[model samples]
Target: MADGLLVFDGYCGFCTRSVGWARALDRRGRVEMRPYQEPGVPESIGTDAATCADAVQFRGPDGVRHGGAAAVNALLDTVTGTRVPTTVYRATAGLQERVYRWVADHRGRFPGMTPYCESHPSECAAST
Candidate 1:
C-alpha cells in the first residue's frame, strides 16, 4: 500500500500519543505521521493551519483528504487493511463526529496531557 499522510497537532500531547498508537499499528509503515505545526506541511497538503488545528487530517494514497472522525476511519482502514472502520464510521457518522469533536476540544484536559505550548511558551508563542 502507498503511504498515507496523517496530519495532527504536535502541540497537543493527547494528539501525539494517539499518533504514536497509530504508528505502532502501522506495521507495514504505510502511514506517514506529520505534525501540522511543521513549516510548509499544511500548504503541501493543500490545507491551511486553521483547518488542521480544528481537526486531524488524512491524505490517503489516492490523495483524498479526510478530516476529524473520517480521518481516523481512513487511517484505521489503511493500517488494518480492512473496510471495518469505514463501515462502522458510515453507520455512526453523526455520533462519531460528535465524540471526535468533544475529545479534540478537551484534549488538553486529559490526565497528564500537557500541550507543547504550555511547556515551551516561547517556541509556540508566535504559532498560537
Candidate 2:
C-alpha cells in the first residue's frame, strides 16, 4: 500500500517536473501521486475546484490534506528523514504564497498540459 497520495496538477510542466524530481530523490518510495483532476479522486478530498486549485496538494500520513508550499515541505521531510526546520519553512510562507500565485497566474508559459483544474479551461486549453 502507498504511504500517502500527492494530488497534483498533472498537466502543469512544473508540477510534473517536480514530481519526477521528487520521485527520483525519494529512496524510501514513501510518496505516490495522483492527478487531482482524475475521476478516481474522492469529492471529500478536493471538495471544489478552487479549494484544491493550487499547484500542489498532498494527503499526509494522518490522511489530512495539505496544499501549496506546505505539501512541498512535507514531501521533503518524508524523503529526507527529518522535518524541515519550522523556523525556516514558516519564515518564508508568506512569500511562498505570492510566488505560487505568480506561477498559477502565468501557468500558460509552462511547457506542458494546462494545469489540471484550470478555472478557464477554454483559455488554458488553447495553450496546450
Candidate 3:
C-alpha cells in the first residue's frame, strides 16, 4: 500500500463498492484506498477534498498525482499493460477530459448510486 493512495467518494454507493471490488483484486495491495470524507484522508495523499470529489485521485509514492481516468492509469498501467482504462487513456487523443466529466456527471446512474445532489442536497449544491 505504499506505492499509491486512491481517494474516492466514501458516501457514494457505487464508488464505495468499486473500491471494495478493487481491494478484492488488488494482489499486491499496492493501492491504499481511502474515502474523501474521512478526516485527514486526502491531506495525507496531498490532495484536497474538492479535488477528490470531482474525480478519483491517485497519488503515487513518487509524489506524482493524477486525476480521473488518468488516476486509474497511474495505478493500472504498469501492472496490467493493456487494461481497458489505459487503452481508453491512449485511444482518446483529445476527449479524455470529457469522458471523465461525463462519468462524474452521470455517476448517480450507476447501479445502487444516488445522485450526489439527491443524496446530499446541501453538499452537492456547495460542490457544484
Candidate 4:
C-alpha cells in the first residue's frame, strides 16, 4: 500500500500534470493520487469540497492532514525518501506559500495548460 494519499484539483491542467510528474518520481508508489472531485474523496479524507478547492491536500501515513505547500513538501519527502525538501520548505515557507497561491490562482493562464475536463470530457462529465 502507498504511504499517503494526494488529493488535488484534477480539473486543473497544471495540477494534473504536476501529479503525473510526482507519480513518475514516486517509483516506489509511495503515494496514491486522487482527484478531489471524485465521489466521496474529500469526505473520505476528512475534508470538505471548499477546503480541497482551495489547495491540494496530503493525508500522510500517520493520518495527519497537510495542505498547500506543506502537503507538497510532505509528498516530496515521501517520494524522494529524504527530508531535504521538507527542510527547504520549512526554511522558505512564506515564499513557498505565496508562490503556491499564485500558481493555484492562475493555473489556467499558462500556455498549453488545458484542464482535464477539456482534455477528457467524457471522464470528467460528472465532476464538471
19-86 per-residue lDDT for model 2 (tens digits): 77788877888887666556545354645445555557777676777777777777677666677633
- Between candidates 1 and 4, name the one with more favorable TM-score: 4
- TM-score of every candidate: 0.87, 0.73, 0.74, 0.88
RMSD of 4: 2.0
Looking at model 2, the pairs that clash are none
Which tens-of-lDDT digit does each residue in 50-126 have in candidate 1? 99999999998879999999999999999999989999999999999999999999988875456545555554435
Q: 1 or 3: which has the higher TM-score? A: 1
Tell me the deviation in Å of residue 59 in model 4: 0.8
lDDT values, one for every candidate: 0.85, 0.65, 0.72, 0.85
Q: Give candidate 4 misplaced runs (Cα > 4 Å).
A: 111-125
**Can you give the lDDT of residue 125 in candidate 3?**
29
Off by more than 4 A, model 3:
78-93, 113-128
TM-score of 3: 0.74
**Which window of ten consecutive residues has the lowest lDDT sum in model 3?**
119-128
Consecutive 10-residue window with the lowest summed lDDT within model 4? 119-128
Ranking of all candidate structures by their TM-score, best first:
4, 1, 3, 2
The alpha-carbon lDDT assigned to residue 59 of candidate 4 equals 93
Which regions of candidate 2 fall more than 4 Å away from where they truly are? 42-46, 85-87, 111-128
Clashes of each: 0, 0, 0, 0
For candidate 3, write residues 16-96 as lDDT tens digits: 667767777667777787777766877887878888889999887668888887887776753343357667787883587
